[model samples]
Target: MTTTTTLEPVRGPFVWRGDQLSGTDEWIFRLSGDQIAELEDAGRRFVADDPDLRFVTAAEYPLPVCADAVRVFGADLDSGRGFVLIRGLRMDGYDDTLAAAIFYLLALHLGEPMRQNLLGDVLDHIVGVSDKKYLEGGLPSRTRDKLPFHSDSSDAVALMCLRPPASGGLSSLVSGATVYNEVLARRPDLAPLLLEPWHYDWRRQDPNAPADTYTSPIVSWTQGTFSMYAGGDMIESAHRYPGVPPLTAARKELLALVEEITYEPGVALDMDFQPGDIQWLLNYAALHSRTAFVNGPDRAHQRHLLRVWLRRDVDRPLVPRFGKHVVVAAPDARQVGPGDDTGRFRIADAATIRERWGD
Candidate 1:
């Protein structure tokens, strides 16, 4: 990231502790009865015309009550604490078509959709897709393996719970600013290193991209905003390529410290997901992780999640390196669904789903 003469102090709420957020209702935005009714009624109307359920602009689905809620949530994610959990949508036994439409339309109140991958997939699933048998820096969501804490390649990321595992699917999130402060005070030498740019491999994910790799600082600061871009798996994968610089022993020690503090008590807020719960996190200010879990009997009982990547085009100013592999979907692009493989876009379709996640 390019440096600037003026540095901005981290905001107060951005310095939150896991206990503080986890124990309080302040961080949660539960839907009220009226709000829920309004959402379902609108969804019923949408179902009549948008049978295909294509991605619609916010104007296409207005939520008068939800508008203020979405705006406040966006402000909290963008400028306040970097995350929020919305509970109580009650998706059980409803019309599947209308249910999905409601979820999509309600989330639009957060922001316009951002492309999640090079193939222009705005929607993603979080299961163990990155099987432990094969290790790669890219596409961690594919394997059921435990993902290291890291920031995704988006302005904001939203994950909705459709199912939970029998055990061990806990999630942890920490403020990037807190980590920065800790490093600055304890390991000043490492602080400078974090700002330096470095490479991360991409062969395991988007093999068709312009190059097999991309570079960015493990921790970057631009336009007075602090963002972390570190992912252990990807960083290690970059070392496999001959062109990437080898991580020095000292740097290795520094990275170890970072990993340690990421999950250190009181630093990261850990929360278990509830069915119909939606977590919206600011990609720039948060680093998150998930614990490994065993799959249940079959796909029917497997842990499942629906994820959406969002972009408020102008709200967050990022470093130039972040723009390197950014891919925008065509305005004409439509949303793809489970089992629907029109090849309209490269997505997690029925065939690939069974093949990768298991039959």
Candidate 2:
């Protein structure tokens, strides 16, 4: 972890307030009819072969018509707004497998998909299996609790809506650069602290992970490029482990202030996800969260989203300490659990997550 002493204010398109975007729908990219048709054709062809998703390439599942759309989405992530919402996939026609195939195929065009769990699941299902809070031992994505704004462990993240929750469950994003600028404006003292290394619990990432805790600065600035990796919940939890340093009062204040600014008026951009909507976010550029949600009575009608983490082919670089969880490359080829398990393609329930990767 090379030390960066400068705490200069960040600039560029990534530093944008949500208020300025309210009058516009520019952040959203509605798929044209041709794009949807190309995707459906590609999805059906790929699924028919029963190909391993981990090894699939954009070339194998070509998106000739939507290639330009893919490039713009990728550009928005790395250079422009740091997020994009793509609407217009008609969910009624897609079965679970076809939906997964289309989502995975789109992800391949933007970046290389990475495993999200010990099961080497390149695609993961985000569904609430229990009502417990993450702090109360439930997996964050597997619970109905409200998640605080935080960065995921990846260069880019994509979530395709399979079913929106019956009520609530609004998705929100705050620009990491915007948050940083605001923090600097308010508390110049605390801004510098964000550039210092902080401990994060690694155990929650995977049961088979090699380490217990990892260290990284909340924000990284290298040669005028700005990026951030933050999860205050994980940082606080890491302190519970032996040998990890405890957070000082100043550090705690800094974390709390950061969260406070995220919720300030005109700061966070919130979205109501519809079925077939896909959201692409550059993790380092934005911190994302979800409101608590309700579900239908049965499993089939419940809220579900397919999520994939990707390592994009972008020029942005960060501090060396940033990646303890994000996989920059695909791991060695491996099989999922026993033959009965389908957790790799889609995690149907929390029991499968726990059984495949211990909590």
Candidate 3:
């Protein structure tokens, strides 16, 4: 594929200092007591509307089809960043559940109405402070910690903040397409590396698996649209392969260039979430990351967020060489071996797998 390195023009660094971000006008729908109750009733009815309850595309269920259901999320503001956080929607059951009951209900309503599976097992997969290795090699280590902007395996990803770190753990996002344009303009030579298949370490895979390494591309395009899954740890893992062509200096410089442009204040959008707020993003077109976060004073109050990955059928196709095959719905769906438990959820400790999961 031809390379285009011009980065898109930067948009506003819209900061939402507390209350300003939670107002009704910013969302597509803001539901209260009676309205929320009505939504619950409607959700149950909608669940029964489709017997099979199979996943559907955004196009399948037009705006008017679930107009009321969509409104519960809020006004659908275009901050150029297609996302919104709805504060305190009520969840009638499981009050103490780490995930706000209202968020779960809303997820179910939105997911089901869109014909997307409101996967219970998948949703439960990454809730609370369970296992991180079960997801992606537990989180990467400090030195190799930077995550280049990329989308996860889903149409839209939602996170409900039950807790926030006292410091750090800031969420950052960039428009993947915008970054692509930047690369095209400022560093055209390196843009093709994004399309080339490179290696990644499935940091969350089973220890017994023959190899922890895998390969995929940084960016993929279909019908002129773009999607990405660029991660530093994954790219570094490729170096282990003997005889594999080394990443040229130009490639390295290009990557560093992309990183610099994408993370700049004018191009990057940052947000700090609070308890009771549910934030959702259209992952297909946006790249997201979280700065290193320190948990609260105690384990019980440690930084916690409920994550969900939803597959939206309307998005671009996965590039063949990237190996986009998915065996499970959520990150934690992988089966754990006899001694693979490290008790640590961070990927930095991944090197200790052999010692921890001794034969």
User: Against the true structure, what is each candidate's TM-score?
Assistant: 0.84, 0.90, 0.63
What candidate 2 gets wrong by more than 4 Å, as runs, is 1-6, 298-301, 325-359
C-alpha lDDT values of all predictions:
0.68, 0.79, 0.50
Better of 1 and 2 by lDDT: 2
lDDT by residue (tens digit), candidate 1, 244-291: 778887668767888888878888888788777888898777889888
Writing each residue's lDDT as its tens digit, candidate 3 over 1-359 gives 34554433333422222233434345423446665555455444433342222232334323343456465343232233456666545543423331333344455445522211211223322222323431244432221123456556445677766556666666677666677667776666677777777766553332343565667777776544456666654566556666556777777786678678766756766667766566777664567776766556764445556555544334346667543343333433222222223232221221112222211
Q: What is the alpha-carbon lDDT of model 3 when measured against the actual structure? A: 0.50
RMSD of 3: 8.9
Where does model 1 exceed 4 Å of error?
1-11, 51-55, 117-120, 128-139, 298-300, 323-325, 328-359
Highest-scoring model, TM-score: 2
Runs in model 3 deviating more than 4 A are 1-29, 32-35, 38-82, 90-94, 98-102, 109-121, 124-150, 203-212, 298-301, 315-318, 321-323, 326-359
Ranking by TM-score: 2, 1, 3
